[model samples]
Target: MAVTLADYEKVVGPEVMDEIRTLAGYVRHKSLQNINSTPVGGGVAEILTRMIPLLRELGVDATWDVIKGNEAFYAVTKAFHNALHGHPETITPKMLEVFRENTAMNLEEMKLEGDVLFIHDPQPAGLIDKKPTIGRQWIWRCHIDVSNPDPAVWEFLRPWVERYDAAVFSMPDFAREMPIPQFRIAPSIDPLSDKNRDLEPEVVRGVLERFGIDPERPVLTQISRFDRLKDPLGVIESYRMVRRHCDCQLVLAGGGADDDPEGAEVLREVEEAAAKDPDIHVLLLPPFSDLEINALVRGSTIVFQKSIREGFGLTVSEGLWKGKPVIGGAVGGIRLQIINGVTGFLIHSPEGAANRAVELLSNPELCRKLGENGQRYVRENFLITRHVKDYLLLMLALDHPGERVVRLAGI
Candidate 1:
């Protein structure tokens, strides 16, 4: 069943729904086309999946498209992804050629026609070259933390980025010294999505049993792709440390995105680290396993996002939205989501994560309080409705560049 705006009103209230509709009305004349690397997997795709439908329901003409790329192309982009996250990756001229060639292929095949051409991440950013012919408002949405990106990669991408009408980043710190207008809009989670929805107790129990996780034993879960940056190995180390003091199980569950080529290698490393630990469940769930993920988080006593580097870490919000206390790394957008000691604990190492996990597991009351705080925080700030409103405002702001106040007509 398709989720309607009316369904969201029960969670976000009627006034928020009214505001979204009003904003949509202002931009009804324009059409939006969101282009990203993949249609499934990462936060960018997941967000667009839910957001596009809502935008259309609100009377805005919105469409989404994915750029085509082969394995070689994705491998280069994956390297670029790592480099952008401040990882050390060697970028050769051949790698740059692979990126350009694939982007050229996408440009030749795709029709660049929309009032607003929203290009996401570096994968499809080269499509902006078509802006001269299309003459549309091109917005580059960078979802990675490029605060200290590899100088070579940043230099290569800078020219293309500066050509945009505006750039949107997940954090203010991620913004660079670009000439174009920059907006800081954090990513959000769909409260009613299968991954974050309210699942029945039976469903949660069944999922736990199917995965061989003991329902009675407290489970620590980190739901993210098997990417090195997500630090699945570190999560296992944390789980091992927690085992010494607390008797609990661990669940490391996620799948791959089409654009990511490194998932298989990372999965192998995770499996090796998990190595014969009956208590450790390393699940490589296929795509569209949101319900199982929801159950895993709900069944777990504590959720971990323990990312070494991240873009915004939507799983952190998903776990928090499910009212599970999240312990995440002190990096990237994770810093924005985990409010240190308030909503959740921000750890710097596996030991820190393990210590925090033990603390939460020992005292259920503190866990409850943190979970309550996190749920409220996500409800007020990180829901999909707030995300749409920000985009609507950004669209409106585009019409009146450099104006302090955007005066919409008839209001």
Candidate 2:
């Protein structure tokens, strides 16, 4: 079910909705072109899928486009992704060549019709090379943590990044010393979306039964891609440590991205890690398994996001939105989502996660309190209504770059 502008007004008040309408009125027909690598399987695509329609309903012409690149393009971009997230990876000259070749091809094929082009991540960053001729306000929205980026990959992508009118990052620390002004726009979740909506008790029960999840024992879930950086194996180790103390089940389920060639390999690694544990359930769901994901989170006793590296852990926000206290890694955007002991515990190692999980499991009152606080926190700060307002303000600011002084004589 697509969220409409009225749905937003219902969550937030009509006054804020009116303000959005007023801001959007300034750029009623100004097109917003969002270009990313894939239209499914990742947070970037998931966010834009929900955001674009709401923007249009607010009177801005918003459209999403995907950049078409072959396997080589994705392979190079995947390595670039690791490098940007502070992972040590060698970017060969051939990889650079692949990046440029894919960019050149996408530049020729993608339509540059929108007045403002928002290129998402390194996958479509080089699309700005055509901005010189396309003549539009281009903004690069960097969703990864570039705090400790690999110098070579940064050098390659930074030139294209500097060409943008502005840049948007998820966290303040993720921002680098770029010449262009940067804005801190945190990612948000939609409470009313299929992935976070209120579900019937029977629905949750049925989903659990279908997956053979024993509700009698506590279920610990880590919902994310089966990628190495997500640390599914580490999550299993943590769960195993916790299992020694309590009877619990572990669910490691996620889908693959078209741009990520290494997902299947990582999935196999996780499978091998859990081969001996009959209590471990590994599911390779389709990219848009919103209702199923929601049910899994609802059925779990606790949710975990043990990522070694993360752009922003949207799954953390999703779990928190469901009032499930998430145990996330103390890295990247997970720090912003899990507020230590308030929303959930942020840990550095498997031992730390196991310790926290054991503590939470023993104290039901503390778990309930943290979960309640987390739900409210996410509702107020991380909902899509707030995200829409921020983007609308950015659009207004970009439209009137020199309108600092509004004349009040008429008023």
Q: Output the number of the lDDT-best candidate.
A: 1
Measured with C-alpha atoms, the lDDT of residue 92 in candidate 2 is 97
lDDT of 2: 0.87
Model 1: per-residue lDDT, tens digit, 1-411? 999999999999999989988888888899999999998877788889999999999888999999999999998998998898888999999999999899889989998778999999999999989988878898999988899999999999999999999999989989999899999998899999998899999999999999999999999999988988889999999999999999999999988766456888898888998888988999989877889999999999999999987777888999899888999999878888899888899999999999999999999999999999999999988999999999998888888888887666763
lDDT of 2 by residue, 57-114 (tens): 8778899999999988888888898887778898899999998988899888888888
How much lDDT does each candidate structure score? 0.91, 0.87
For candidate 2, list the clashing residue pairs, or say none.
none
Q: What is the lDDT of residue 314 in candidate 1?
A: 82
| Error in Å for residue 400 of model 1 | 0.8
Model 1: colliding residue pairs: none
| CA lDDT for candidate 1 | 0.91
**Candidate 1 — number of clashing residue pairs?**
0
lDDT score at residue 327, model 2, on the 0-100 scale: 97
